[model samples]
Target: MNILLENIKILAENENISISKLEKEIGSSQAVLSRAIAKNTDIQAKWVLKIAEKYPQYSCDWLLKKEGPMLREMTKNTDIYGLLEDGVENFKILTTSQKQIIESLQKVIFYLEKQDETGRQEKNKNN
Candidate 1:
């Protein structure tokens, strides 16, 4: 139940949508959504259908059983890096600030990788 809610939160964040928006899209009130997520009551099958229809990118298996890939399909174009790049590009079309943030994050990731490599080399030297 908590796991289902957490996955919903993750999906909402990744899609740049608010929980309110998700609830509206699924034709459920926030209170009902909360109750369903908390397992206080069983979620209706219609609600599941609404979500599956709206967010086809989510793996049904993962959403229901947590036993498969998080995404519906496995493809180079659908990898996390590809999705992140697509998100940054979409944000770039809307605002320069988003582009700057993406650039900063790229630089931070580069620096972290370099630091990791350096640490590995130092460890090898000590060995």
Candidate 2:
């Protein structure tokens, strides 16, 4: 499979979502990804960027060059809000990478809470 398709599948798996659902979020044409995968061609850059924007865990570099891990490995020292060090008023000025990290962290938090909720339900059912 092409890196583009592989990346898309990887992103969906990581997000615990279906490819069609992910395509919707990424603003891709219906079946565009599937078609590309079937044809075994490179995915459009615009679609790649859209996926990257929605799910920053998928490293852009890895998507583009097939280098590094599929997901970005963040360190505890990651300066998620360092861009606001100058002032909070200019948070809009943060670079794309900084914004992506913040977004990715939000997604992670949501995913964890969902897992916790499911676990609690399962535990209650077992009782």
TM-score each candidate: 0.49, 0.58
lDDT of 2 by residue, 20-64 (tens): 888789888788887777777655555765776676556765665
Question: lDDT tens string, model 1, 66-90?
Answer: 5577776535443445656787654
List lDDT for all candidates, in order: 0.61, 0.67
**Could you say which candidate leads in TM-score?**
2
Which candidate leads in lDDT?
Answer: 2
Our tally of clashes for model 2 stands at: 0
Off by over 4 Å in 1: 38-40, 74-127
Error of 2 at 22 (Å): 1.2
Q: Which stretches of candidate 2 lie over 4 Å from their true place?
A: 75-127
- Evaluated at residue 100, the lDDT of candidate 1 is 39
